[model samples]
Target: MARRKIVRSPDLMLLRRALKHLLPGALLLAAAAALPRVPSLWRLVLELLPIYFSLVFVGGFLLAWQFDRSRIALTLLVLALADRALLHGGHNVHDVVALLLPVNLAAFSWLKERGLLTPRGAIKVGALLLQALGVAALARAHSPAAVSWLSHPLVTWPALAAVPLSQPALAAWLIAAGLAVARFVTRPAALESGLLWAGLTTLLALLAGKTEPLLTFYIATAGLILVVSLMETSRSMAFDDELTGLPGRRALNEELLKLGSRYAIAMVDIDHFKLFNDDHGHDVGDQLLRMVGARLLSVGGGGRAFRYGGEEFSVLFDGKTREEATPVLEKFRAELADTPFIVRGKRRPRKKPSLPLPAGSQKKVSVTVSIGVAEPDGSHGTPDRVVKAADAALYRAKRSGRNRLCT
Candidate 1:
């Protein structure tokens, strides 16, 4: 019998990260599905669609500017322009937008974010101008002929006819979707995932007819997702440590505010971390911090970990006493001491390097932590004071002996 390979914690963590970025768009899409389908209100909603989209796009542009996510701002600008073109121009322009949008969106999203006021940004601006000019030129030059040529079905099969898009448009959507998926898989971020779902919503809008209320609904949803995800990304960047992927000091500060009277705070510090950093390098030190943060995430006793800056970390145990949390912190300290951390050097092998280093290129070493647990007391009335008390205990722990827990 063949053995089944088990999925580990890191894989699950990666999956969670990918899915989290999809939440904003997915929620809006769900809301769109649940909208009331009343006949009387439907026309009103249709009339309001353009107005609604105008607000969403304009507001989204301002937010993108605030967050400095230029890609989202530009995408919204282009989408707004397309909406305007479809409203003013005829069938040829519709065909022009249907064919051009997916391709342009793919280009805008996949291209590196060059800031809007720069040389590269000028090129992007030029591209936008060219797209608009092409639509106008084509509409005036070809009249109704452009629609027939652009909408010509590539396949005569009955199944293919049921698809709501023209051949070139469908092909472009498919390629754009593939790129979005690939980008999301490689680096799970708001931009990549937003591009993936926003592209789908745009395609759905095209399927429903550009001037239809459904178009407004999907396009508005797309704009909202782009804006909201950029906000989410901005929040994540603020509260998360870039190197460790752990909650930073600001997050810890907010969390501390929400704690009750009986909570325990444990300050954890890696022993001789500076010596390690100096001996190895900052890059290696970063790797160590990430590894340590990962381990801290799995600490026991209902504790939530935060990267409390540098080589220090903090674990907040809501509603737990100091005595109760001490043993848990001790166990964590001992377990971390036992786990061997492999330090990969410049000459380390491309594959996973195993025991017995080849001329000191790689080596396995045990890392340990000193922990101090504190509970709220009359002496430490406030959260900040409690943290200071915990730090004092941590200093005591370090003084007594390294790699041990203190009360």
Candidate 2:
């Protein structure tokens, strides 16, 4: 029989990052296509072209000002062109495209530690916003029969417009707005509803006639959502440990790379771990590992706890110097020393404490762990070296005598 291959999935955070790139482009493209309905939109695009050029020029002027994501930034620029090519001139693409702003910002804020609204995030947001606003102005000034949705800032702002004058436009805008509100009230779960609303609106526009631009916008929105979902699923599987419910080694490396300054990295190992497995058999050994894993998680606080593989784990303390994490580490050591492991064949109805155990049957087994501590040095070549240092220290602790900590 062929062995089953493990499938890795992206976490919600990665999906959100990918969407960060896709949404801006898609939104700006929609806005660009919506232009031409307002005469001023053309003039603004022309006038603002120079400004956008300047932004591109000065985008890297200050290290702090830069998003450092040049590839995605350039992609947004290209998307501008695509919008004009596919859906230009007084179209009904605004409603769908406008939805991207809230979706993008909200997802970034909630799912990822980093967001599009972050300093770098704001730059992309500003760029895309400027483009959308410029288009709305151009479309209104250019076309006499053009609708208010294509003109007024209140109506055209990607975040939330003032409300359009045209009944159809106003109706569409209102519907989109309502869905957006609902999504915000309950994110993740409600996010799908907002997407559905956008999709349904596009369908309505198609049935009403002159649906080319609307259809294009709808297809693109759906595509962006799909891309983000796919990436998110992949990110999760890559970063999280399946067995211990902690971060996997790959995720630890990624987290360390993003570390700002002054942090602690600690290595934890079950004391005499191999002996437990040999004497009690693999099943009991697994139970002890899980118990230790739970204790580590309890003491991890806000820091990330990761499984570094069999019988080994790690924790990262952010924004704190080594001294700051010492108390926490000591606390964890003390708490874990008291944890117990249930031997095979000694369980009640439920495995853990909350569930009632069978009356009169209360016997459990247990084990302990040793730890090694290290402070991260940004100047150091890589996270691996730092982790190795902690690992070495961990071995020293075990040699000195199991169930003790070393730095």
Candidate 3:
């Protein structure tokens, strides 16, 4: 049975991994096929194609292997814009900017991967600002009527407002907007590429004698800002653990306020966690926490695991009453008790050096969890009260027996 289980594990992992790639590719292909309509869109698509192909392949490959898809896709778009600018023989300020934006955005990921961007992503913000400023300057330099007075806020505001959007600005704005959408849809790369595309397109359109530059520039710039801002907000929310991800206690309060529907809220607590942490070490305790979270997520479906501080987790199940969720929760609780958490490879070397325990010792510790289940009591009150009731039930389970569930 153990051999069969070990053999089956890799196959399960492989199947789960494949779905992530297949689903996104199918969605992107559908979107790409449906988005183009006008002659100008065709022209834009044509200009973007080579770079797009190179980006999709190279970016997809790198992302599939190492990084997240959204970031890679966004980066690829930015690189594509740079390649487009270089191909068009742009040496002017707009051309230089077209080259720099994507690179800067890509740099954010590099810094982040190294764990260097924490405590505030100040460097990353600075880089983005620099790119924005460069694009603004380049756009200003191209217009002779505005060059002398570019520094004058009153004089430049109108042009700055319209450059990427006017008939003279339309091309750049389109590119910028496309890049912005890509960045938000995918990751950070879109940001730089979008700005460059917008800046360069605007300059090219102006030089080529486009009519109605003002309306074109305003709409494009404003639209990109709005889209990118929304995407950034969404991206932040999606990656969060949802329960403990927000700072302070505000996140929990916010979630409690939003509860609705006939949902089952499960409050799970690690059985004897304080003693377990003391007996093994905090390192093992941390691993136990993560393992418990993973188990809860696996059994409770993909979308509902929440770290409700310390060794406690709160899971809200949609489409199930409290009674229906009980058996499923109990089964998972039993699984946790049955599994032996051997802390060998999972421990940090520096945390317990030279303390010679058997390399494969299973005697050090074991962990289990207790869960309190609650259903929405419509007449009982708010979500907070519901949670408190569940907590009371969880305490009851812990008192009755450490590794069990109570409703």
Candidate 2: 10-residue stretch with minimal lDDT:
4-13
Q: State TM-scores per candidate.
A: 0.88, 0.44, 0.50
Give the TM-score ranking, best first: 1, 3, 2
Model 3, 1-407: lDDT tens per residue? 45211100122322332343234323433343344445676577567655545544454435423433333343434444434333333235433543354344434333333212343434544545565565556555665444333223333345556443223223334444555445434432333333333333333433322222222332233223223433433443554443223222345556666767666778888888888889778866776665666566567542266777888888777667788888888888776676666564443453345775655553434567889988777654567777788899899998997788888
Q: Is candidate 2 or candidate 3 better by lDDT?
A: 2
**lDDT tens digits by residue: candidate 1, 1-407:** 75322211244345656788888878776666556366677677677877888789988998888766778988898887776776667777877788888887788677888778889888888888998888888767766765687777777778767776678788888888887788788878888778777877788777777555677677777787788788778888999877677789999999989987889999999999999999889877877887788777778789989999999999999989988888888887887787677776677663544664455554667788888888888899788998999999999999998899888
lDDT of 3 at 402: 74
Q: Higher-lDDT candidate among 1 and 3? A: 1
lDDT of each: 0.80, 0.54, 0.51
Per TM-score, the best of the predicted structures is 1
Off by over 4 Å in 2: 1-227, 344-355, 358-360, 376-383
RMSD of each: 4.1, 14.7, 13.8
For residues 1-407, what per-residue lDDT tens digits would candidate 2 score against the true structure? Answer: 65322211223333443343345334534554465356786567556554553443233222212433332332333233334432554543443334333334233323322434467656756766675676567555665444444343433445443232333444554565566445434443222332433333333333333345444443344334323333343455687665555678898888888877567788988887888789878876665665566556657545667888998999988777667776788787866566544564534342246765675564454466788877766544356676787888789998998788888
